[model samples]
Target chain A: MSEEKKRKKILEVKDLDITFETTAGNVHAIRGVNIDLYQGETVAIVGESGSGKSVTMRAAMGILAKNAVVNKGEIIYRYCDNIGGIDYNPEYDENAVWKEADILKMDKKWIRKHINGRRIAMVFQDPMTSLDPTMTIGKQIMEGMIWHYKIDKQDAYNRAVGLLKEVGIEDAEKRMKQYPHQLSGGMRQRVVIAIALSCNPDLLICDEPTTALDVNIQAKILELIKKVQKERDIAVIYITHDLGVVAKVADYVNVMYAGKIVEVGNINEIFYDPRHPYTWGLLSAMPDLGTDDERLYTIPGSPPNLLHEKEGDAFAPRNAYALEIDDKLDPPMFEITDTHSAATWLLDPRAPKVEMPKELKLRIERMKKEAQANGSEL
Target chain B: MAANYNAEPLLEVKGLKQYFTVSKTFMVKAVDDVSFKVYPGETYGLVGESGSGKSTIGRSIIRLYDPTAGTITFNGMDISGKMSRQTQKDLRVMMQMVFQDPMASLNPRKKIKDIIGEALDIHNVCKSAAERDEKVEAILTKVGLAKEHADRYPHQFSGGQRQRVGIARALILNPKLIIADECISALDVSIQAQVVNLMKDIQEELGTAYLFIAHDLSMVKYISDRIGVLHLGHLLETGTTDEIFNNPVHPYTKSLLSAIPIPNPELEKNRIALNYDYKTSGIDYTKGTEHLIDGTHYVKCTDEEYAKWTK
Candidate 1:
């Protein structure tokens, strides 16, 4: 914990706002989003579709759609020359210099040259669509390294082979000659990870990377990513709707609702002592194996349409415990602990206290008890 | 769940095999000798990973794919063979299916009313257009959708609403069995609960049985009375939900159950999935005969293997 505090903050997103100007209307996609990532921590941004989880990450990647307009805020990224990887450049800086750049303000050329693949890399959701069908997997993994690092072909080939091995692909030499179509979905995703790792990125942005694979394969992929992240000491920002994925991978959780972050906390706080009603709904909605309840707890309504500006909180209409003030004015982030806060009127000092569902409370207790019985820390 | 055991099954699949001919020289055996039964008012979950042929079995039972071998008996009548006109009409009213992708399965160009009322139109069940609209609206309302939504296209509604439309379409005929193939896989967590609750409510009120096919073990356990674990086109085990979950005999079933990510962070972090590789396991699935664990549980295995697994 002490060393973790000493680690540098690699990325910070402050008051990020984005909008999509469609033919019908202007859709305010992202609204005042804030996130912080240390050198090697995992922060998960979770929400339903159209809640702007992907848009926040896309903005960080500087790969937002052409129609998207970043009206406000900035993504500050800092990387040092000592960012250790196989492709480390010895000629750069003698003592290693820390560099900072606003991704929003940086030039496209500069981003493509330094930030895109060198410092930050992304593994998209669909491996099939992301990988080139025309090229062999080996050449595809080697292309970025050779182009970006100005390395020799033979050196890139050996590095690519080693990467494929690191991602758990066997018979690396034989598999390298295969095309994307010939490989299975799990193998293809592994190859995609290999390509992402080829750049030796300090920050890995995985946008629902394992959603396309099966459950067994998803577990393996998650493990592989965690292993790689630990080894590389890289910060990861995982964007997903699956609570299971988030619970398994995240060090901290960001609960997004209608383009705004409603809750932020560490894994234990978010899972065990969630303050926001949305987080409670999401956690309870997931069907655990040991639950005996006939009916699951569900959020009452859908997310609000982003095109139409609402009066106050976007989730107010759906929250059963919503206060009158929630409709009149948006609630600011209420600090629960040093690392935990919730943006909901329910967390207000003046508002009436409302607990999560009775059944859900029992379930969480059961989970904690079971965890203790299993000799695991909660 | 055992109450339905004494009653005859509504849908019975026996030695079902569905194969696809990739070329003249090679064929893909998607569903090989898979068998199970769905009794009235009880859900039978078919759980399997990708390429496990769970979807293939659903498609074959719905008669979307011609089975390569075996028989499908629906309500004690063989529907696997070439159908007569009356049998064909009976099949339409007796069994319906809700697909995975609501938007793609539903016709985009068609209005919500027409989409739900298509079965009625096919069978000429309604007396007039008003009667059809009334039936559509009633079913739509039953699925928790508004009557006003019937006029809009499938593209107009959100994902959960469209799935409600899909359920409405399948329920318009009031079929005895509804084959929901990964129906809630694409939905958000909160919406998933809503849909699951809605399905459970419909089942309670209408007494309709469901053949729920999905890879999500937690959801399958939640909704299913009985579960059949499929792996690589074979039915590895069949048992009551408790038996399959708590006393899984097959290594494949154990691996699948262990793969499910519990939502609790502490437990999830400590989860070490039991990995099962068929190539290295050295167990021949083809040589296995069905072995009984109990009245409600069965695992396919050779006698020698069965003795080891059961012990």
Candidate 2:
């Protein structure tokens, strides 16, 4: 990765904590989540259900459920209108962000005006919920630009068409005129993408955008996101449980387990040299087409109850390779490589040496074969 | 692992066609001319995307949805056409279904005892209310739920527990076959495996066949003996689970199999993104002889294309 290509930090989240006040108990959804978003880089937050990957991003976007409360975190955002071919560079002023506003502390009403959609846009998991069923795709796409940027109707329409084309939606004019219901699942997603990019927001947060889509449609949507990210050079936060999706589009990966990031590294490091046991369990459970394993492995037990306050490593009970120290004390993320870090006892010098699963070793061999076949570096 | 050709089929669907009348003139061919068989104690997997009528087939076989045409033979008895009241009662006791949403499938107002007991009551299995309660408790215990849980509501239980309740409800009838329509798709992955294992264990103990319908081909391969792929209201292909995945024939099946997001990062990056061309259409089913079919596999394509495949 070149330094020049190394994008400036567009958004920075620090020590984020969120809890949902439910009748059963307070559910600690996210804890001490720290993440950085560089301009034009796609950072994928991957995890299983209730792993708080979605909640973490939801907190950043100020869309957490009403029962939820953000106890700590500062989502520092720096926006430039130069994203969509507009030359509105403010000379990259460092103090400009603090001077302009505080997203975490600011009133949501104010945030909606200056921050939401205008500077930072989001595409949620289900397009049916995010998109208006009553309105035409064209109107919905143009509505954001008209409301936020005060852009003219024709220009907004043109921009919407451009976005539709950019997302690989053919016959933009016809697709725009059609209603959301008329479009297929894949097409509807593309329309949502168009709507998200209507204002040319600097940061695009896609929360499981392809989960509802079929596999074929999912591939197209992933490609569309990558295409848009590269073209617009906008920072992206891809939140999903599907690791395959993350691998295709994400430059970096964050593995979330029980409301905390168990591992964070570049895609290669996270996949090939994953240090966390939880990450290893996840990797091992996935069914390989090439593998001859009769039984598909599973991570034993369920995720920890969010209502119950966790004592040490949240994944310790489920992790087969968990050390005694893991249950007694929370392991800090040890630095493995410069770009790699994992929260696991395996990285601890004092911890007992445990080998990876035999299934994983076999999978690694297949992966190497596939890499060789594709003529690509693993 | 080819399907055991000589073995006696436990459940055979012949010329199954489920078409819903849209208004008066038009009919939505949700499931058109589909047929398949599940041998005794075999796990037959039905795999398809949404709108492929996978769930409809499961529902139809279990008598939850009446087929517009076709005959369903269970244990060599045809039960597809309009059934007599007594026959319907017997069918209800013989076959059961587990829906995708455990929350929705279970009755909200009814207690767990009443929910599981209803089937026994319908069948007149118990002589008295006390006997019914005892039976329900035994079934509850069999599915890994405590007998005390019989007093609780559906909302009181977690998703996995509720699914277990659904399983218990289906199993209490001692049905010959259970249609689990994406039953575990709504569950967490780890919980999904547990539920799957429980289903397998129950199958071994009770000798009940299963029509496991799901979108997850990988999981289907894990549980199913034979697999059938459905696409756009047509049965594209059918084969043994290993043969289906390892040596897929239909382009759609191959594409669908490849589309599954394998968790391996290296494989994922190299996965060929599927692109289908639905526009270059084939098939004139409207102009065809419009006769019912006896085969499990049906392909909606041009006659030439069909003939080529047959060759």
Candidate 3:
């Protein structure tokens, strides 16, 4: 089904490595990571805190901290340089091509003027912190357009009200004049989404956008994002640790563990037929509504310390089915299908085959049965 | 299991009301005429949204914020208002609380030993310094921490470890009831499970009752024997875990249950969210009353709606 849709690669990251120089020691925040984001699709990065999910997205957006260092990587973003009547359709003719810039190599001024908030936008976790309390909501929403596109004040103002209405905010004109504190938590988030969407960016990076909202409000926000994505054909990268949220929104899933993507697959593959042990632990650890078990199946140990250099697989100590190779060497990404891969020694053909835990298997079966009863596809 | 009818509840809250004066003209009814009972060796989960006043009810029960009206009966003694010094001191040892934020709850300047030991010292539970140290060490170990951790500051520990310290301080009092207010909301999934398992184990070992206050429905269903659904500072529904989850009668309860995001992708896709509108529903809570549906299920509704709902 995914192959049938024509997808344009909007962003690509190859071998991205990030480190932080802390007083205690240097923290290896991001390992040799890679990701491919296409147009009009949602990809979720799931992990616990300190798993470097936020750091990776921050590096992509050129918003890393001062103490952070990009050891080696290339973040290539593709955008059509419409000036001077340049041909943009490269697929039809070899001469027609778009401009590509490596974000890491580009100067800060160039990126800020051309790329950041123009072709890509970010929505932070806390709307209160992201939205300026001093400025009116309308002015904050219009600031991006006026600065980036050099639009007139009246045009920006008209579009800002439209954007607020599009985000499902009632009384858009009245709310535009209100400050951030005057709005409720859900309304503040809606305003944040409106500001992020004002620029009409190609990709919207939402970093735990709904973590601060209540469940009903969270559902509304997720639905709003999905609706906006469909209407505008914008690719979304959601960084969150909640599996339930991931299952609802994502088409693809990346399970990160200790600064590395341990597994990458479609949502169905990750939830129903998970290959990595850490993914299994995450799924089992969540207490579902129907779960009646005495105790949740935890991942045994806490996340590994990133201050020290990691040896072999970072999750080897916590993996219950770890093989001898997991302790000696880091495992390569073993392909399960064209769209699914897992970094685990157990995926090696020479290693003995092991099944997922019985509890998880039973749960998957129950989920499948429930889905069938509801006439939904898994 | 059925509730013990003859035995007195460990904690009984009757017509509890906590109001805050937001302005000179307006008073915010944080907890408005709510009532529940926490039996000995049972977990009573209180689930609601952020402004629904679940935390306010907890604070009122623990007397952190004195209630504006109604009585709180602990071990058959009415300890609501204007208690004697000895009664207040005795009530302190019988009831304790675990706050939500571990970092903010624990004093950064004090060592874990002193933080937990202060409770013992205030209550004069220990005879000497050695006995206090021994008790602190024992409680720390009981919460899955090493005795050596007692010497470290709160900043040195992780989020889960700091929550363990909070639990240790609450357990050191050897209270009959502990009100855990969103204690596991800040931790990760794996660590949350560990902490929850620890709570269950402690409850089993000590047979202590708990007023588990949180917004997460699945966790509440897992830990609670009976649950009370609160909305706008009112107790809308109260029932056993099974009765509340499987046979929700109140429209508010149904809406809350439907809003919970289950983990299964396919199931969640098929899930239809029920939005409850109080304005359009035309339900006046002031005139509404609690209606018993079954043996252990109760729903708040008007007389006409109660007949329809029960029917």
Candidate 4:
């Protein structure tokens, strides 16, 4: 795992603040967000709707709507010259110094030519909307390569077939002749993934890619993404609300609330030793296969309305372990370890140490025991 | 809860089949020969993925789509299709459906009071305008909404609030059975728990049975008394919640259970997903029969496979 620390940073989002200008008021969607994605690693941003998970990723990809306002932030993307080359050292380059482009600062035309769908690609939540119903699967897949690389139709078709096979589609040749409606939901999502990977991108952003799929299909998609990530050695950012999906795929987890990340840590640290009360609530709310409880441990209230300016910590109202200071002032992120940090009043030196819910503690213990029994790394 | 098990079932669906003809050449058997019973005041969960015919069963039972072949007995009365006007009205009051998309189900032009009170008006349940208003207010509060919400439109509410309005519309007439077709799946995880708890509370207070159809197995295990697993329009397993969770007999049931993503990092890292192949398993569905494993558990398998599974 020491090699993980040596991984180079591919994208860095610093102090991001985004707002949407609505008819009623300006909705502050993202609040001082900070995140870094390392090459060949998977980072998951977990949150409910209106928590700004999608907005952050959309901002990174330069796809924010016209109504959106980037109040203050920089989305710096590092371009590695030796990607898809032999013996690639992501850390440093002696010959061609890596070029860093601020996606927020670049115009739409510049980003389209230099970054979007070539250096960075995105897979949306719904494949029905992302894909064109009129076009055949073969044409749709080949269109990206033909546009970006100026490749011939024959070569693009060959690569498209190879991509379909790589994504585990049976009868790749026959499937290419069909339209989007001819495929199943799972199959459509796989085609979308294939299209995203057609350009050999350096970063892949999946926004709830598997939410529309069944459980069995979801498992297959997650496995396919992991396999492709390793083979391509590209950075991945998964934006989803399902903690279960986060547990299975993410190397690091960021727990978002209202509009800010309340906790950020490695997967094991966030799941086993969570610091924020919001994280605890999220973990307890999910019903596990072994759970026999009468009632789910639901978070007390709904998410805050972003139309108005927030006073303190946005999650303080629903947090059962909230301190008085939480309502008075927002807490800065307190570092627990080099890889773990949380923005909660409970982490303050002056605040009393609060224990997690009994149910979560017991669940964590059982999970640790199961992991040890299976001889698996968490 | 156990005492209610001895009572008559609120809804009984037997040999239900709904088929849609796509073109002149072929037909799609969306639901085929499915059967289940929902006891009074008990939640009977129907679990399956898309194209598994779970949603078709829900729509068929509520008479939105006529069943090709089957008998639907609600309150010990056959109301499958082409019911008389009076019989239709009576059945409509006794059974209500909450759709998956709240935005599409409720009308934009209609106010919340009119939407909730439409059934009352149609059935002539309320004699006066004041009584209708009172009933609407009562149901709005029952679903954790205020009376002022009745004057607003459905677009004014959030997704969770719109779902509450949908529940209020369903509960306004005190239906004996509610067919909730993926009602909470559209909401967030936190709001989903709230809605599930609300459904449980409403069941306790009003004794309303539910045909809860969803793909999430964990939520089904929590709220359901009995569960029916569907795969390719076949009811492969039916058992009590504990029986189904602890001792799933069918290979399809095992695969479905194993496919669920558990929300624990350490446990999920070691989780093994079981894949079931129909062609490789060599279990023919034509000769498949439902065998009783224990008091309340049943598994669909052939004679030889049933013996092997039981052994």
Candidate 5:
């Protein structure tokens, strides 16, 4: 039995619509998307390329490209009463009042002063590209704290060294003096995580943080992020397409497709009992070990091109279980459980039931049996 | 299921050592004293982390970079020494390569047809332009692309489609062995599955042996018949897919396998990666002999190291 923990809404994006002006045409990147991030829980956004996963997070961070236009939507960020949201739990204070702010309406100057680095921090996919080549590792980590809190040079230096040690880097003093190029890929990513945690942000946005690293390093980085989240009780938004990474990091799963949240569910619900056909395709397609099947299942067609004018369901062309109604209208998000929901025509009460791929079903059952044997949660 | 033992090996590397001289006194031993046999129509996966020299082994086999030492034999011919013009020409037809990044590998300036058919022009295999177009279109359709797509440039297609073009480029030569260096690593999971399925379909149709060099363990295990685990430029372990996954011996090999991210949240949460530090393990590759365990499973270790690891 799990304890009833009070979950507070931290970041809310309602009906987000973003378009980019290109030479070919106006690409409607984010089309009427909605995402809800709660306090102290990791939420993962999974999708194929050009599926608007990064664009949604970029919108939340106020880092959208100049050529992009936000046609509609609102992003609400709630500032908790306690610093770092440490005392927002009911045990500390039953009345945890949150002061809400509309992130979209805020000007760049105001946002930079309050929200950008102090309350929220982001780690990019590639650490090499994100870090300044000319700047030393220590300066990059210290700059955020110095700029946000206006701390003294000595204080910032001391904090940077501490953060480096916290991220599991050895010889922090020597590493702080070296540049990004001097460090390995895994070490550089550790430095990036150190910088992100330097400002003590409550919400950490990691967009494929370990995608550019090797597999062994990836496991360590994922562990490090989880360690920090537990220690500080920070809410993490993990943006990645790797299902394994999602299973390792996320508490909630948001499956995005064609700029929309096609499926939102708890990690178990999404992995074990997925309803959407697109979700089924993604789950079945990953090449797993010890499988006898010669052919891996693939989504029948590519994602819909956003440059062209769309019709009913953008996924209708690729869905194997697409109903005639899908051609005429977009499917609404049908609720499966309190924490599980999927956008698909097959979820309609009148529609014929469709089963997930046999291989995926068997795989889930096998995984559940394994977990049960291991005495872990199933 | 694996390389046919009765059949002759398609490619063999004996004591392969590929070292890069950084300075007059310093050298980077990218691939150090590694040897493996890839039989006909089998997929031999070379897996390692960055600087583990999986790609170096592939490059040396393809003659992209001349190996600093060792012998590389292809189809019963020793291709390690200076290649005669006839031998080079023959090798071109028997071997081809697929690079990691489709964007960087393909000629962005040229049309898909030209990019895929460049081998035709180089080898003078096609009689006329119409014939070249026909060959290119056939390969395109084989990889799940249309004839009209041959007219577009690399930028015109999506990441998956561009990768198809890369596969089409390799297929146009009708090569016996294709060294796919992280071919599906850059694509999304769905698209990666599609590309991998395409590769499998092609392999079934042509019976081509693939030297698949990648870091993704799951995918490597899925597609490869036999796997060679590389670490710090040495082949620490080599075995069939089942042997490598079910019963890994070396501590480094075991560590690599443990680091694979499980897709089930329940199981993944219970997982902890086993750590193996070479400096602390007291295992030196420079002083070891490869010992065969059984059924195509081999581990490069000394007598004491083997005894310790097996126990």
Candidate 6:
């Protein structure tokens, strides 16, 4: 479905640039990222660590590290509620007219009051670190509702218990009384999700929420997120490195590499007819359960240094299909279809043809066998 | 059958148990009467969760942690009982270990050459310093690292490169069995493929055995010939990789297999979620140590549902 035709766009991040002032040098962590999230769709921004996916979402929630500075970008939010607590001029509110605020330039106090946890809630990867050891699970869930919504005590308790049940937690009333240590890692994550969903925010950003969880627990957490998104109709931006998780959860995928998104497409487009060489490598590298390849294919070379501020494509050094032009100038994103595009020199019409690795060809063939066995394909 | 009985496995464990006293008196049986065998030129995968004691098994087998009870037999030699300092040093060369955290396992100040050569020096395997250096270079190349990288410190390399150095250090001693305890868990998925492939190639080249311990079921199935599942210090199931994935006898193993997210989007969306009760499924591992007899597999275990799941 087209994002615009939906009721409203909750968040629109345009041309975002993020840099970190480090001891070594100024690291350009995010370079010109643009994203749009409709009311309820789950858009997963996926890549390996240091891919700037987390930085982009952290910018949206106004939660960046001390050294981070946004060089350029506008994070615009259109909300029925004044999440930022700014003086609402009734005349300023119109159809699709987002409150265009330079998130980088916004005051810390204003952003804290309006943006964070009030309208945009986040659930991080590690629950042990994220959760306060001193507090009970019930208090943690109630704390957000009381702070943001200012609801009554008994009502907050009721909502907290209800949320626990909503996320498929058994014995919600009893679970609410327990401390963080009493619960397993999976249950602790569910409690964290309950806290994030308690606010009923416009956007829910999950940064590798299940990376610390086991496979079964990871599946359960992903299912919980999907359920919450469906019921609350909140826009979700799932940040993760696992493509398997992305394929299961994301409706649209943005492949990031070294602070820049090299490809963006529908799930099927990216998986089936990928245009970028990096995307091809990533797809092939995934260990197919059904495949019989003697050796698994690996993408050679490491992620580039973000601190160096490379002039060309950051992935050019590692990309096997890199052209002469790729080494000198950054390739513009080429439009493959109405909904799909990739930033690669090889996609240029003038560039010579280079087929995907032979192992990848075999992987696709094996994937076809799986499709036939499963009786479905994109 | 005679071939299976007569042939000597590269590594064997009989009733291996490691119990830690969590409180003043209450001891937590982290690994209780777990036993398995690793055949030569084969990969045996150990799968478990955080408290499952999979890593404890890996450590105890390589003598990193002293086991409370049970016997560890390496190449028909019982190395379980207390050994002399010299015999222990000699055993270290036969069995090497690769830890999960490459950055922490490797010393940041030391060069790659010194890290690999230290084992050679400790075992007195090398004729001289030059011979040790040459062996380190050869193993570095074998593990896909450049010969020049031997001079660089750990801080200069990436996570994947550091893991390669770790592999090289383990392989330089010409160890018969390498225990990789969650070796690729900390790496990126794309880079993880490279490390796994490197391990497979090295094993094929040297005819070395591997005891691969990981929580990732799919990767275990991909790399291992035989697989063992551990839950709460109990070895619940053991079989071939294909049998474990396709026809899991135990409910826990079945649930674990079903839990792995399929790459296909449609299948993943349509797959039915398995709901196994964690609280009831957990055995009273604290008590019943006397009744728990070690056999080919966990039989008449306290977790009856898990034991009966196969029946």
Point to the candidate with the largest TM-score. 1
| Pairs with steric clashes in candidate 6 | A83-A114, A84-A114
| Candidate 6 docking classification | medium
* Candidate 5 lDDT by residue in tens digits, B1-311: 33466788999999999999999999999999999999988999999999999998998998989988999999988899899998888888999999989999998899999999999999899899999999999999999999999899999998999999998999898988999999989887888888888888888888889999999999888789999999989998999999999999998989999998988888897587888888988888889899988889999999998888788
lDDT of 4 by residue, A166-202 (tens): 9999999999999999999989999999999998888
Q: List the lowest-lDDT window of 10 residues for candidate 6 chain A.
A: A82-91
lDDT of 2 by residue, A1-378 (tens): 367654588788888888899998899888888888888788999888888988887777766689988888788776653432333444554444323344678777877777777778898888888889899999998887888767788888888888888888889998888888887877888888888887767889999898788776787788778778877788899988777777787888999988899899998887777778887887776655666665667787778778887688898888888878877888898998887998888888887888888778767777767776767665
For model 6, the stretches where C-alpha displacement exceeds 4 angstroms are: A1-7, A82-100, A353-362, A365-378, B1-6, B278-311
Model 4 ranges with Cα > 4 A deviation? A1-5, A82-96, A376-378, B1-3
- Please identify model 2 stretches exceeding 4 Å from their true place: A1-4, A81-102, B1-5, B128-134, B281-303, B306-311
For A21-68, candidate 1 gives per-residue lDDT tens digits of: 999899999999999998779999999988999999888888889999
Roughly what TM-score does model 4 have, to 2 decimal places?
A: 0.96
The docking quality of candidate 2, as DockQ, is 0.47
Query: What proportion of the true contacts does each candidate reproduce?
Result: 0.72, 0.47, 0.61, 0.74, 0.78, 0.61
DockQ of 6: 0.58
What is the per-residue lDDT of model 6 for residues A1-378, given as tens digits with 9 covering 90 to 100? 454563566688888998999999999999988887777788889788888888898888787999998888888877665433322332355643345555566788877766777678899999988899899899999998788767789999998999999988899999888899999999999988898887777788999999899887888899888878877667889998888888788888899998888999988777767788888988888877876567877778778889897878899888877878887899888999987999998888998987877776766666656766888844
Q: Against the unseen true structure, what C-alpha lDDT does each candidate score? A: 0.89, 0.79, 0.88, 0.89, 0.89, 0.82
lDDT of 3 by residue, A1-378 (tens): 277878888899899999999999999989988889988889999999999999998888887899999999999998765442211233455554577888888878888877778778998889999999999999999999899777789999999999999999989999989999999998999999998888778889999999888787788888889889988888999999999998888989999999989999988999999999999999989888876787777889889899987678999888889887787799989999998999998889898989999999999999889888888765
Query: What would the per-residue lDDT of candidate 1 be over residues B64-108, giving only the tens digit for each residue?
Result: 988999999998789998988888889989899998999899999
Q: Give the DockQ (C-alpha) for candidate 5.
A: 0.78
Q: Which wins on DockQ, candidate 3 or candidate 5? A: 5
Clashing pairs in 2: none
- Which 10 consecutive residues of model 1 chain B have the lowest summed lDDT? B1-10
